[model samples]
Target: MRSRIIFFVALIAILVGGYGIYDSVLKNKDKSSVVVNEIAPQPKKDSVEYITVWRTLNNIDRGESIANDALKREQMLLTDALDEGLRSDVELDFSPSTLFNRDLPQGALILPEYITRENDPGYIDLLVTEGMTLYPLVVSNKNLISDFIRPGERIDILTVSSPSSNLSGAIEKPIRFKGVTATLFLQNIKVLNMGGEDSEQKLKPVAGKSEDGFTTIIIEIPPTEVARLALAQRTMHLEVYRSREYEEPVYADVRNVMSNYIGIEEMRGSKNKNGREGEL
Candidate 1:
């Protein structure tokens, strides 16, 4: 009975061991399959693209700081976004006043002041530096008073008594006369027929230039005459009258003057009553 029991126990042990080995093999196969399925492929990354943009500054007032106020904030933002991929240049335009504010057209830049050859062209570093005003006078086609008026030169402007009359009429029937001294831009006022040998009544403009094609004159008149001059400019043709005596005179020799004089020979012969056939 003991020998049969021992044999049966031995057989059961062998069967149990074989089943454990098979289960272990299955588990290992399952783990290998899961490891293959769980592996993730590397994700594709997109390449970053960069672009260039152009900009300009305009209407900056005179004496204003450009570095801090003009370019500080904008420059930081642009540089940050561009990350060394952007570049820029500055242009300055000067004028008398600020009236118009328009965005620069594509690929164009307008400056707040005139950048002369003397100004440094490197990157701007200061904020309290002086700048020129970007006014319409710089770009406009119209003439301005600064173009015509000069220093120390005298000018005449006819003042109008009535508000309706123009400058020409005011000069003809001058309600008043204003005498002004020309300053920097005196030549801007057209000096027409300045040294002509014609009478004042027949004085007409033979040649002239204006501040911007508009005739201007500087003469010694009274403050009250400004109105008439304004009226003449608006209504009739204004004439500029200049005295030859007051201006630099051109002297001619007596022989030259007598060359054109008629009957001068007769007068010379009469003076020589001796009739000695003198070389008159």
Candidate 2:
């Protein structure tokens, strides 16, 4: 009877131990389910912001330059910049007083790429206009103010040459056309240099060649006008007259030289003992 009682007690202890194990397992399962249902924590958002930048004050037209007064400062969120490529006032190192390379509407951001600098070729190139070219004219004392002419001075150019070979088929006649007549060539052209001032070796007057030696002056002329200049210089003597009016261009193209400049023909073709053309 004692053995029977012990066996019954063992069975009851086993049942209690099994129930305790089952309850612990169920508790752990419930905790895992609760963790799975909870939402994931989001990454912290960036809070730092606010950037101040310069914007155009008015409508900046294409090819129009920007002045200091053309800009105004405004604040924007740093986090919301247009892109990583957008330039900020801090990143740019240029003067506000620069020409805009392209059109910028009013209230537009002043981009660094929109302005031109002195180092750029386009900056220096702007001094020359369309359909125009810079040509260097070699000059001498033929200009009354040759010694006094400077780079920025304006002057008039005249040509004295023999007219078209009226003596046709007169070749083998021992000589070509005799340059004598004078005409108005170019007017009011800007002179870039005088008396070889920009060169290391200064030009000295040619003693026995012509009355004055050769000195070169630079001039700007249109393409259409260039042919006239070349024709004059190729077969004629070129002389300069100072422009009286500084602000206006003057042109006088007269075909009749005998009426205007009397006795010039007789003065042009005289010769020295060396048979060289005499100085005017």
Note the clash tally of each candidate.
Answer: 42, 2
Candidate 2 global lDDT:
0.59
Compose the digit string of candidate 1's lDDT tens values, residues 1-280.
9999999999999999999999999999999999999969889997544333223344444323223223222233444444544444333332211111332332233333323221334212111122311111111112222333322233332222233334332224433222211212111222221222333411333223433343222232334544644444455433332222325333232344346444544454553466664342
Whole-model lDDT, candidate 1?
Answer: 0.35
What value does the lDDT take at residue 104 in candidate 2? 78
**Residue range 103-204, candidate 2, lDDT tens digits:** 778898766677775456575344344566878776544344434555456778766554643321122221323344554667788664343542332223
TM-score of each: 0.26, 0.37
In model 1, how many backbone clashes occur? 42
For model 2, the stretches where C-alpha displacement exceeds 4 angstroms are: 1-120, 141-147, 164-179, 193-212, 245-280
**How much lDDT does each candidate structure score?**
0.35, 0.59
Off by over 4 Å in 1: 37-182, 185-212, 215-280
**Model 1 worst lDDT window (10 residues):** 132-141
